[model samples]
Target: MTIIRSRDFTGGRPWAALDIASMNGIGTRLHWTDQPYIWHINEGQEVFVVLGGRVRMRYRKDGVEQAVVLAVGDIFYAEIGCEHLAEPLGEARVLVVEAVGSL
Candidate 1:
C-alpha cells in the first residue's frame, strides 16, 4: 500500500503526474501545476478533483463558453469530447482519473 499526501506532492512540470492506479484501463493520477493547461478534448470521460489551492476551469458547450472557479475539495467532471482547460490560481495539486492516454 502506498500513502500520499496530495498537498505535499510535487511534480516535474505543469500537469506532471504520478500514477496511482489503473483498473479496467482507467487510470488515476496525482498532479501538480502552476500553469494553465491547453484547451482540448478528452477521448474519454475525466474526473478532476482539486486537492489544494484553486483553479479556474473553462469549458465550451453548445458553442457557448463557461467557466467555474474550483477550490480545495471541488470536483469537475469532463464528459467525453468536452473541450476544457484549467488555469491554476497558484501552485495547486489535483487528482485526475480518466482512461489511459486520454488527452
Candidate 2:
C-alpha cells in the first residue's frame, strides 16, 4: 500500500497516465465509445489517481458491488478477480496503476 500524489503522476494535460502493467505506462486512453464497451473483472489488484473531471468506477469487492465516483486527487483500489468498470466524466483524465489487465 502506497500513497502517490495525483499531480505527480499524469498525462501532463491535467494529470499523468499509467499502465496497469507498466508503472511508466502513461496515457493509453480508456475511452470506449462508438461501440459496445464491456467492463470486465480485474485479473489482479489495482489502483488509480483521479486527474481531470471525474472517474466513475463500478466493481465488485468482498462479495458485494461497489460504485465509486472519484474527483481530482481521488485514489482507488481494485481487488483481484473483482469485476470493474471505469469511464471519464466529460473528458476526464487519471493516473492508473494496476495489473496488466485488471479492468
Candidate 3:
C-alpha cells in the first residue's frame, strides 16, 4: 500500500513522473512539470487530474483550438485520437492515467 501526498510531490525535471501502476496495458503516473507538454493525439484514452497548482489545458476539436485553465482538483478527459496538450501555469503536480507508452 502507498499513500501519496500530491501537494508535496515533485520530479527532477519538467514533466518528470513517478510511475504508480500498470495493468492490462494501462498505466497510472504522478507527474510534476513547469512547462507545457507537446500537442499530440493519444493512442488510447487519457485522464488528467490536477493534484496541485494550475494548468492550461489546450486542445483542438474539429480543427478549432480551445483551451481552459485547470486548477487543483480539476480533471481533464482526453478521448483516444483527441489532440491535446497540457501547459502548466507554474510548477504543478498532476496524476495521469492512460495506456503505457502512449503519446
Candidate 4:
C-alpha cells in the first residue's frame, strides 16, 4: 500500500513527477509544477486531478480554445486526441493517470 501526502510533495523542477504505478499500459504519476505546460495532444485518454493549489486548464475544442480553473480536489478528464495544456497558479501538485509514454 502506498500512502502519499500530496501537500508535502515537491519536484526537482516544474512538471517533474514521481511515478506511482503502471497497470495495463496506463501510468499513474504525481507531478509538481509552478509553470505552464505546453499544448499537446495525448495519444490516449487522460485523467488529471488537482491535489494542491490551482491550475488553469486550457484546451481546444472544435478549433475553439477554452479554459477552466481547477482547484484542489477538482478532476479533469481528457478524451483521446484532446489537445490541452495545464498552467499552474503558483505551486501545485497534481495526480495524472494516462497511457504509458503518452505526452
Candidate 5:
C-alpha cells in the first residue's frame, strides 16, 4: 500500500492523513490542542482513528451529540448524515477514513 504524507503541518508534532479510493471516501482531520473543540461535517460517512495521543469526539450541540474518548489506536465512525465534534486531549495525531467524495 502507498502512504502519502503531508508537509508536516505542526512541525511533525501532530500528523494527519486521508485515504482516497473508489470504494470509499476519507478525509483526515486533526487539531494541535484541545482548546479548539470544533465540529464539522462532510457529505459522506467517516471513521476516525487515533494514531497517537488522546482525543475526545463529540457531536455538535445544535446537531447530534455523541461523545467518545479515543486513545491511541482507537477507532470511531461517524455515520452518514451525522454532524459531529472532535478535539485533541493534548498534543494528538489522528487519521480518518470514510466513504466520501472530494474535500
Candidate 6:
C-alpha cells in the first residue's frame, strides 16, 4: 500500500513523474509540469486526471484543433490515435494511466 499527498508531490522537472504502478504493460504515474507537451498520438488508450492546479488540453479532431481547460478533479480520456497536447496553466500535477513506454 502507498499513501501520496498529491498537493505536496513534486518532480525534478517539467513532466517528471513518480511511477505508481505497472501491470500488464500498463502504467500509472503522477506527473508534475509547468510546460506544454508536444502534440502526439498514443498507441493505446490514456486516462488523465488533474490532481492539482489547472491545465489546458489541446487536441486535433478531424484535422481541426480544439482546446479545453481542465481544473482540479477533471479527467481527460484519450483513445488510441488521439492526437493531443497538454499545457499547464502554471504548475500542475496530473495522474496518468496508459500503456507502459508510451509517449
TM-scores for every candidate against the unseen true structure:
0.97, 0.57, 0.96, 0.98, 0.61, 0.97
lDDT of 6 by residue, 1-103 (tens): 8998878888888999999999999999999999999999998999999999999999998999999999999999998888999999999999999999999
Which candidate leads in lDDT? Answer: 4
For residue 37, what is the lDDT in candidate 2? Answer: 24
- Stretches > 4 Å off in candidate 4: none
Q: What is candidate 5's CA lDDT for residue 35?
A: 46
For candidate 5, write residues 1-103 as lDDT tens digits. 8554422334333333333344423444542443434466757777777766788887754554667889888887776666777777777666666544423
Model 5 lDDT at residue 58 = 79
Better structure of 2 and 3 per TM-score: 3
Stretches of candidate 6 off by over 4 Å are none
C-alpha lDDT (0 to 100) for residue 75 of candidate 2: 81
Q: What is the TM-score (0 to 1) of candidate 5?
A: 0.61
Q: Per-candidate RMSD vs. true structure?
A: 0.7, 7.0, 0.8, 0.6, 4.8, 0.6
lDDT of each: 0.94, 0.55, 0.94, 0.96, 0.59, 0.95
Q: lDDT order of candidates, best first? A: 4, 6, 1, 3, 5, 2
In the range 4-48, model 2's lDDT, one tens digit per residue, is 543344344332234333455322333212112257765666666
lDDT of 4 by residue, 1-103 (tens): 9898888899999999999999999999999999999999999999999999999999999999999999999999999988999999999999999999988
What lDDT is obtained when candidate 6 is compared to the true structure?
Answer: 0.95
Clashes of 1: 0
Model 1 TM-score? 0.97
Model 3: per-residue lDDT, tens digit, 1-103?
9998877887888999989999999999999999999999999999999999999999999999999999999999998789999999989999999999986
